[model samples]
Target chain A: MQGREILFIVLSLVACFAGLGVVLAKHPIKSALSLVVNMFSIAFLYFTLEANMLGITQIMVYVGAIMVLFLFVVMLLNIGSDRSGMKILDLKLVPAILIALLMFSLISFQVLYPLFGMQYPVADEGFGSPEAIGKSLFSQYVLPFEVASVLLLVGIVGAILLARRKA
Target chain B: MLEEFISNLHPVLAIFVRIICFSGIAIMFVPIQVWWERRLLGWMQDRVGPNRVGPFGLLQPVADAIKLFLKEDHVPSGVDKFIYYLAPILAFLPAFALGGTMPWAPAEGLYGLLTPVADINIGVLYVLAISSLGSYGVVLAGYAGNNKYSLLGGLRASAQLISYELAMTVSLAAIILVTGSLRMSEVVSYQTGPLWGIFPYIQNWNLLTPTGLVAGVIFFICAIAETNRAPFDLPEAESELIGGYHTEYSSFKFGLFFLSEYAARFVFSGVFATIFLGGYNMLPVRWDILAVDFPGWSEWFYFMHSANYWLSPVAFIAKCFLGFTVFVWVRATLPRLRYDQLMSIGWKSLLPAAVANFIVVAVWIMVTNLYGMIAGYASLVVSAIILLVLYLNIKAVGFNESTSTKRRIKMAKFNLKENEESN
Candidate 1:
């Protein structure tokens, strides 16, 4: 393998370990922190793919904004420590895990693996620039983009409503 | 011999040299920055702050560093040992790493590696991401300390940073719109020579543009809050929270906190200078005129032609100092904001203004492109009026929180007889 490929492999390994850490850690904040490590390594993965804009947005939005919110809520709530490792394997969680894994495998085959005569991805000139993304977001996927934003706005309203105390 | 030495340097080695050399220079300035703040703030506040350590108190930071080193490192029995130790390291490293994306000089120097350590395509986002990570240090420090005061400080820090990040991001979005590139060097190069590319005398620094001025003002405030400087320093307000998140920290760990604070301040100012004040381009005048007007200086012009390589770095430093002075000046002048006021400003005032300014600026650009300059001016006027009306309506509707001081005055029900007899 080339040096860059080796680096990518190392980064992906680290990212996988961090992802496991997020699930394995008992303390919510520590789990959140593990998730942060996951985000960072994934951003590096994006960098390796030459999707710098995506990598940076990953860092900025996920690590910076989303993780801050997570850490904030975690700290504010002061989650009690848990030693219940078996609780995660309880009956309720089993179905959830099975369903999630099934979905993941299905998508991996149908979309990610290029099973339907699909070609692998490559970075072209300006493939992952802000301008490129902006153009595509505005032109090709504008409706879905606007709809997603509206969904987010609704989520925000729901959250506010949930958080507010009755006067 | 020097020219040969410079030319012979390997590209990777040159980058390492620049990174190490630039950080060394930046680190050296920290003590001087501390001294400058002391002297300047003293002059401002009518006090003689720290004149005994050395000439103009130059050796004070050295003395303080030594003192911290000599002091025994103490760990509280109740604290989380590993994270407690890791907290300061977490804080200091990110502050230092911020220099990674900073484009210092032009690439005219040997091996074209003299500018910054990492000139990644997403330079601005790198900065934002690193800076966003800064809160982790404080939060972890507070949690590991196992102290209530520390926890409060950490919580405050996370909230404040998240709130201001929105405004900061929006204002930065406006700058990105204006520059049309996320690359830091591209942004700087766009600012070269004349305001708005029309006026010859005025520098084209973003602070001079109408849209730029609004974004710049919002950005400056957010940057200040981001660094936890006054009047937004609720996280470590000494009078209330004691030492705040570092209350349990002592000796060198405490010293690390202080060093990171000042270092982050300096670098943030450098960033401010780069983005808004035109990095390393001293005056916004075209230099070709000088080469044309006088043939004798042709060689000099050629030498400096690789402007970012040598000359611009010095100018960049000068601009950074100017920014640092503003930081100190503001610290000396403004009082620490109350927590509620700080939150309200970040969420209510700055965020909306930044978002509106960004939209206006974007529309202004579009209009100017479509129907010439006159339509741009007309749209600008219309937007200004609309913004003014919105501001008034928002204010009238009480979006700005009540600025009145605390309502509960602790006075014993105005009893004059008892008050007089107490003496």
Candidate 2:
């Protein structure tokens, strides 16, 4: 009815379609690109929700950096050859379909059923600011924060070792 | 008429005017930048440059654009039709949009926005997001062109991003820590004082601080890489790739890539100037401070005191041009780096250095603020010792030196012992 709501709906549809495109696209690169689109639309959704910091972070980390790396790997591998050998009746499809159905039902029952058609509340002051996040992260979630960083450092070291051992 | 224009200008109308003016400034400067780089490069290399086309080849870019316009646009047989057409635009748009967050000038008087356009809280994040998105243009162009050279160039460009961007962001994080804000205007304003808290005599440009200087150097190197400038320009090493990502493009599409490269260079220079050098401020001291502390000298140095009022845009442009000249100078002076060396510097040296310097600065800030001068000095001494140790180790060993292929020497005693054990 209103302009903001209309805009929200449009972005939601874009996110949904891009999400579907990620799963349905034949080429891995195309799927990766669709995932990128989905990420950007989610960032826009964050913007509409007035979580400016979160929205920018989503774009900065996911769409800009992470997805670029994803696409780079995709391009480097040059997987242009179509690998659509599996038919609809393939046994591999059954487990995947069953898992998808379980996820759908679980999400629908737990989240969608309870929260359906409810208007989202506006964010409070400094809800998604760097200061807000930093304070909480340092105070309440310090263990998790430090652990995550250490984990990342380990991964980086492992990557260097893997590369260096070859040389 | 002027009064009427200012009397009740609507917000939307003002924004439109500002957008038009911003874009107009950028568009007009592209040719000038191209011409300036050409002439400067010529001067450095001892040649006349493009003096034949127009007055000092001022109109050379215009001629080139027209020629490109008239040239036949060709599409090769193997290229992806849709993506090939779409690639140029993706390459072009991001460069233009990258200039959005920069505070070129204040919006006092008849100018539109009071702060910079898009002065959102997450100014730095917005900039990082948009500039990082620039790699897409290269990747798409290289892939769509369906040429091996183009694809290699594109892949190199993305790989380059993965190496350099982490260091770049870490260096900027140091600056943000020092400033306590991410806004460009805030960063600039913070620089408009002493070099550090203690040094009242020196301008407080971030370049003067110990950790800040290290961060500044790292930031500039990363900027050079981000813009894909020489000597870090492995993506478009012409001798190797034969025009690189735009190898398959012809006519105006090729022109677009050329244009975007220069524009992005200029914008990145603006960003560097803003973050490190003090955006539009010509000097560190404020007018009020000068007038109060030494009124007689203030009259003689009116230009220093009054740069912030009306000359911000001019100051911004001059700084950008100076930065651009440096970019050109480096291009003329340095050879293109080998790809392995490029990666080595980005990951091993710059990244580690940036991370170390950032932690040192953060500790420096915390110590200096909470405790007395003694604590601050102690922290400084500790960091300096650590730096010295690291430097000595690096000197003693080597950078990215691998030694797996060296021949192994057998010890005589160990060999005899092993023979006895076997027997």
User: How do all models score by TM-score?
Assistant: 0.88, 0.90
Report the Cα lDDT for residue B213, model 2: 87
- Which docking band does candidate 1 fall into? medium
User: How accurately is candidate 1 docked according to DockQ?
Assistant: 0.69
RMSD in angstroms between candidate 1 and the native structure over all alpha carbons: 5.0
Q: Interface Cα RMSD for candidate 1?
A: 1.0
Candidate 2 Cα lDDT to native? 0.82
By TM-score, the best candidate is 2
lDDT of 1 by residue, B1-423 (tens): 654664578866766776787688778888899888888999999999888998878899899889988998989887878779888988998787777777766545442455677777677778888888888888888888898888889999989999898898899889988888888888887777567756754557898888888888998898898888888888888898997889899998998898898888888888888889887676555555555666798667555555634567688888888888998899888999988899899988999999899889888889999998779878877897899798899897664344322222223444555788896
What fraction of the native alpha-carbon contacts across the interface, defined at 8 angstroms, is recovered by model 1?
A: 0.68
Fraction of true contacts kept, per model? Answer: 0.68, 0.78
User: DockQ of candidate 2?
Assistant: 0.70
Question: Residue A105: error of model 2 in Å?
Answer: 7.4
